[model samples]
Target: MKKNWMALLMGIVMATLLLSACSNEGSSNEADADGGSGEAATEQVLKIGNDQEPAGLDPHKVPAHSSIRIYEKIYDSLLTFDEDMKVQPELAEKWEQPDETTYVFTLREGVKFHNGREMTAEDVKYSFERIMDEETASIAKSYFDKVESIEVVSPTEIKFTLSEPYAPFLSYVASTNAAIVAKEVVEENGDLNQAAVGTGPFKLDEWLPDNHVKLSKNEDYYKDGQPKLDGITYLTMKDESARLAAIRTGEVHVTTLSSQSIPLAEKSDGVEIKSYQSTEYSYVGFNVNKEPFNDVKVRQAISLAVDRKEVADVVWKGDAVLSGPIPESMGQWAIDVSQEELYQQNIEKAKELLAEAGYEDGFETVISTASTYTDMVDTAQLLQQQLEAIGIKAEIKQLEWGQYIDTWTNGDHDMLVGRNSSGSDPDRSIGFFFSTDGSANVWGFSDEKIDQLAEEGRTTIDPEKRVEIYNEAQKRVIEQTPNLFLVSPEKFFIVRDSVDNYSPTANEPENFNDVVIME
Candidate 1:
């Protein structure tokens, strides 16, 4: 009986040994599957899917939002806007306005650019001067046109003297276009279209055109413990379905979605949708220099013929709000022009105005728009149909983005259906379209009275006074009918559940400095 017990114990030992060997083999296979590491895989990289590639890295060269989004990661501005769109210090620690026309900014100490050079007042002065340089032909020059001079008070202090008391000066300084760049880097690189070096939370590591733009965290960032993610990769996926698929399959962590994709995103699991009232304004502009359109009555007739509410509902899928030239996102500066009779759709009045303008049989016009934006194409088609009801023959001319911009810049189009960004401040919203010398005034719609009012709106310091000035300007603009303002479409962002603290502002790009990735 003792011998039998020993045999049974040996058998048991053999079985235990076999089990241990199989467990070891399984663990080895698991490690091999996990890139030869026994520990579970952890991703430190945050991948974002963008619909289009940025035009360039040079902040002054491109006003495209795609470029601005990338710039927000690679550069630092003097000031920045908070979640509430309030001005806040960024590179500048604090600032003081000594007088109506004089402003001083106290630079943050120990700030280092991506190139390891210490930032000083000289860099700030150079950046502003570069923007104002006529040779650069910067699209952002208008924002700083009010500055009379930039003086360096000290290595860490800078003062700006404006030609007038520009109330929106602080907001302009806070813009992404006003990002402070290293003078030495700019000189070495010449254009800074491909390379960028700035004192921000991240540094541009690599940019593969039409592929991805990669950025790595700045370890020596002045803001301590910032940019929690090790790096970020902006993947360019122009096709909307491709972007949605990338997010759904865990290939990308976040992406912006169009209104049509909102329903699909809502039904998808492990995805969260966040939306904000966009400051982008869509409009149908008439080139006042063109024949027939030169007549204010013709412009007014077209504005009265189309229904903004219908456009907002059908095109935007009920995700937009009707707005005037100044979107409601401008807060108190937005004049209540909804009650204005010109804005109402009066078919009879439109026909009467057309008849009065010697177009009793209607007129032939071409509407030019960029085909890159599907919404704009739809808007043009809708406008064409609406105009047809009043015996107007509208031809839709769709062009590529580059051609569209060129046509508009050269004033070669009769009419245009496009969108413009209305920034956080009222000055940025109104000045670019209405000011006589505004770079975006492609329709040649210029009024001396409107220009004076816009000047006063920016120079006036008191809130009430500024509002009064802007209200008068808006009313005049409506009467002139340079553009038929449409709606402010809601902006949507889709993020993975694992991404935390990824909030996007209405006027600014997404700041990922505090973004965290959950395991």
Candidate 2:
């Protein structure tokens, strides 16, 4: 019995050794497929890096595109822009303008939120109401100022009633601000900021703030076989040099580059640099409600005082176009005005205006800007020196990006330097800022005639009529002089050669669904 027991033990040991050998062989094969060291195969994952991380998962709370890009993958708006930069169908497959001031949207059928709940018109209504509701304190509330009410027609249909025939209303619906949410889930959880549930192609699987956010493809997405990659991992790198270094070392795959660092990207092998027409326009906004700027003469004086040509060449590397209030990227909508006439460095004229405003000696003022980009800080410094040359004591104050945006949004700054991207359409650029309640109008500028023309531009489908209205509005903005329209900065994106399907997207929210990597 002892000999039989010993033989059984030996047989078991030999069998165990064979099984271990087979397991090692299988793991090695998987590692070979993964292109990693000999280890177990893992699901395919793509890594991306962005300048900032998500502030919140709630669509109403996320103001910046950096956060919206992540939220966009997890949420679906009533409408979405197509590759041609026109509003097409998303959750809302089709729609109709029942009247000049009303829009009705027909939601797509057979769609499910990440939480397995079927979307309904009530959810859509709730989403809009939530943003407009004062209790929510949504940063994008200003964009929806024209929205009177959102009505649910049925389970898959909804109507948006506006105060006027706003031309950019539909486009506003397509913006990151009006993105849909799981109404029931948000109501139950009371906070969607930590995690989001939507009908987008990808689901938010994990989010580690300041470190990484992971999104897994939603197999039950309305569109089938979408989100080509198994999953996406977005990492945030605030430091430009560190971000560039990370991409060089294969730590991250894609990133947005500062205007100055673009050339370095072009010189690097296995990297592609793409330039796009950004709707973003830099300007010096005067506090029209107070100070020496309250005088139209002082405002015009400042507009003519700054050397736009020099600033464009020095700060933007001569890759920008000097313009009036209206950015030239608007194409046909852009007024056919001469940039040479609209903007020129005329210190003599500026001094004259200052004298008319009763400040021939010039006045001391503070210019507020974010310290994130070296270019922004440098531009502020340059502006200070230029203003000082004409006896203007300009004080430059650099604040953190968050605080700077808050101060500007609240209209607390005497003078602020910034830009706004026009997006795919001219209406987004022209109407939003010039309109009375435009959230972006921190300068607190308003005009009934200008508002009327802007409204006409929105409702009149006739191309010629629209151009006439926009042209007149542009002229009015120049006369009011709340802002000194400076230059439009060129946008740049850099990706490693290994990253495929990389291209310039004029619109800020790029479609990353088609991006792929080589094996």
Candidate whose lDDT is highest: 1
Weakest 10 consecutive residues of candidate 1 by summed lDDT: 32-41
Which pairs clash in model 2? 167-458, 270-497, 279-421, 279-422, 280-421
Every model's TM-score: 0.89, 0.85
At residue 494, candidate 2 shows an lDDT of 74
For all the candidates, what are their Cα RMSDs to the real structure?
A: 6.2, 5.9
Please give, for residues 1-519, the per-residue lDDT of candidate 1 as tens digits. 999999999999999999999987886675444334342236657899987777788987677677888887888889988878889999999999988999999999999999898999999999999988989877778888889999999999999999988888898899788889888777888987888998888889999988999999999899877877789999988778898898888799999877888899888888899888878889988888888999999999998999888898878898998788888887888977679888799999999999999999998989999876768888999999999988899999998766776786778988988888888777776787778877567788889988888888887889998888888888888898888888888888899877766777775547787776654
lDDT of 2 by residue, 1-519 (tens): 999999999999999999999988987775454443445314446677677666677888656556777888888888878656688888898999978888999998889888888888888888888888888867567667778888888998898888877666777788777888877777787858886898888889988867899999888888765765678888878778977877777677777777777777777777777778776778777878887877888887777778877888888888888666567776777774444443667888888888888998888999988776666776788788888756789889887766776787688888887766666545555566767766566788777877777677777777787788777888888777777777887777777665555466665435666555543
Point out where model 1 deviates above 4 Å.
1-41
What's the residue-level lDDT of 365 in candidate 2? Answer: 94
Worst 10 residues of 2 by lDDT: 34-43
